[model samples]
Target: MSLLDADAHTAHIFTGAWTRSGGGDAPVVSPSTGTVLGRTGIADADDVREAAARADKARHAWAAASFEERAAVLRRAGDLLQAHEAEITDWLRRESGAAAGMAGFQVHVAAEECFEAAALASQPHGEVLRTAKPRLSFSRQVPVGVVGVIAPFNVPLILGIRSVAPALAVGNAVILKPDPRTAVCGGAVLAEVFHRAGVPEGVFQVLPGGVAAGEALVADPHVRVISFTGSTAAGRRVGEAAARHLKRAHLELGGNSPLVVLDDADVEAAASIGAWGSFLHQGQICMTTGRHLVHASLADAYVERLAAKAEALVVGSTEEDGAALGPVIDAGQRDKIHRLVTAGVDAGAELRAGGTFEGLYYRPTVLDRVTPTTPPFAEEVFGPVAPVVRFSTLDELVELAGSTEYGLSLGVITTNPMRGLEIADRIPSGIVHINDQTVDDEAVAPFGGVGHSGTGSRFGGTRANLEAFTETQWVTMRADPARYPF
Candidate 1:
């Protein structure tokens, strides 16, 4: 059976029920083999409006549902996701070009997201407030009515589910807009999971389409909050649109994170950490180590070690020949990655290893002698390319790392843990890791970025989830009504 056909209904757009929407079917093409796997439904402006209206209508009853009922739904969804892990992982590997490990990670995180959201249902939802007036006063959390979630092609399931599960648990109906490139695993799979879990009709819908669908979702008055995860440019547009519509936008955007290797660090250990950060899942993650800053004393050795590590990685289609690194998402991304590598080499950076591709598979690349001004170093390449630069002093390293507009994740590697922590404190970013790689996420930890990276309220754990999906309303009760001065 086809992977998409195994567990998820990929034939139609999910608007509570499967419905043929505006743009019709779009072929799901595999990045690994360049073959059409299946077809998924697409939504357009009108379809988005229809889904939004339905979600708005469904919001009230869901909000009024008992916490136990909502938690039961979430728990069931989590259980279902785990029970069908093999099918989901296969779909992820085929559709998203994820290797076994990466695909497994997605399934794990996705299930954990649902489980965490289930726990949110029973958490405290209100706070009692002290008032000067003789009255019982408190603040309670309420759903934001309807949430519009826009997820990216890379890390599709995790990105979409992070928002979708939380919003639903908090009692808001959701309309998810998965990237057209990854609609099946990202959108349709979630639809199947929630549907089988007994989510109320109109409480959750998946609309897979391109720009028009996303724009329509943002403009729709019924969508009270927009949770967007993608490129910085696209996120800016979503944020602006949500602002114009006067709604909350939780944006988890792009990053050009730095991995700092101190002179005191072990060259081999540091290289291993950097390689994992830069090459994992083809380095398409938001927190991939885009820039590697090595102490001038260890720069040469570090570059050689990192290059060796990059060269050792086997790049191929996992289906044909099990490989460490699978193909990138598509040709466009492959070309973009090559272009950045070419630009870096053209600007005097030495290509230490891997500046080549076969089909959609781009090899793990390492560039040495890269300066702060190098093209790939300055931007988020979003590929398996590590650009290493030398920093003469700690201050120089801090300056080089902080020079970029993107501030998502930062990693400091050193033997002295306190020293690493001190260095990490010097850099301003949403997430900082001492003696660890930049690419990391936990459902229990609050995840987001700062500055251009995101609109940093945050997006995990109890408080952040509540803040992201719920609004606080103040209420008061009195034994007798009191009159104000007329």
Candidate 2:
């Protein structure tokens, strides 16, 4: 079945159906070939208000629902997603410019998110507190009422579903605002999941809009929490707005995640993993390994090996899968990547491989001797550009990795796992991977960043989601009324 009618003009998902949100329409184009696959209407402020109001109105009933009832719906949604894997993955490729591997990973993991959330629904919510008085006191977790989920274009399915599944499992209604770049799969397919799974109308919705709509969602008093995934700048705005309204906001923002290579590490293995970490999905992922810190001893050989791996990658459109990389989200992103490349080169960095571009599909690029002060080193490239920096000492590796404004993730590769851990401990990051790449996430881990990268609110696990999506209530009981100071 069609996720949405191809000719449909609106991008809004209302309760159990697709509705015409009032706003200007825009054509959804593929960055790979500039093909207009579909069109979707932007949600105006009024539409956003209406959607949130609907979610708020139904919040109490969802919160009061039984755990088994909620779990069943979430499990059904996951099962449906798995059953329709081929259909959803295909749309992801065309609409999001994702390669087959990237698309499949997003969709499949998104389904698993729902299943994991179902498990979380049955876990203990709070703890009993010891009191001096002859009264029983304990805390109970209650739903936050309404959650606003704002997802980015890079990994739409996983990002959107990761937030939605947890919110629903905890019995809070959700309003999802997907990036216009991937609305069809991100917003519409998600709506179909809950609707077919028998989730109540108005409890879950998808509002297809841009900045105006997002502001509207955050401004509303009914939206108690906001979960956002995107750039650091945008995340700052979202966090500030949520704070101004006394609402909780979980931000999974930008990352210039670094991958380290020690002298003892396997240069070939590190090169292979680093190539994928830097170039997968054209390196738009927030956790993409944007910086490469190799010890001086291995730096020369590592760059050569890394460049060979990058050069071997096939660059083609969606029809091609043997090609490892795909286009960035759009031309603007492509231009931004090129500008960073130019800046790196001007700073005396050598372009070891791929600095060329054809449309939005910029080839996987490698930069050697990128200075610590350069944009590609200090900032996130968000493109398939890995800026390699040579570090002479362990202290220099720590200093270079810690210098960035972003502290989302880091990767350390060494023959000794303990050595990798010791170095990883020195870096400030939420995700520290040993002998691996930076881009990583699962349904049940605490997935957020530190410093400029996030608000320190983790997005997975029973405790994490409960903390993010629920309020704690201290309940007490006494056998009889006791006299107190008046």
Which of the numbered candidates is closest to the native, going by highest lDDT? 1
lDDT of 1 at 246: 95
TM-score of each predicted structure versus truth: 0.98, 0.98
**Candidate 2: clashing pairs of residues:** none
RMSD of each: 1.5, 1.3
lDDT of 2 at 338: 98
- Tens-digit lDDT track of model 2 for 176-270: 99988888888888888788898998999888788999999999988999999989999899989998999888999999999999989899999
Tens-place lDDT per residue, model 1, 342-449, is: 999999999999999998999999999999778998888999999999998888988999999999999999999999988888898999999999999888999999
Ten contiguous residues minimizing lDDT sum, candidate 1 = 1-10
Name the regions of candidate 2 deviating beyond 4 angstroms: 1-12
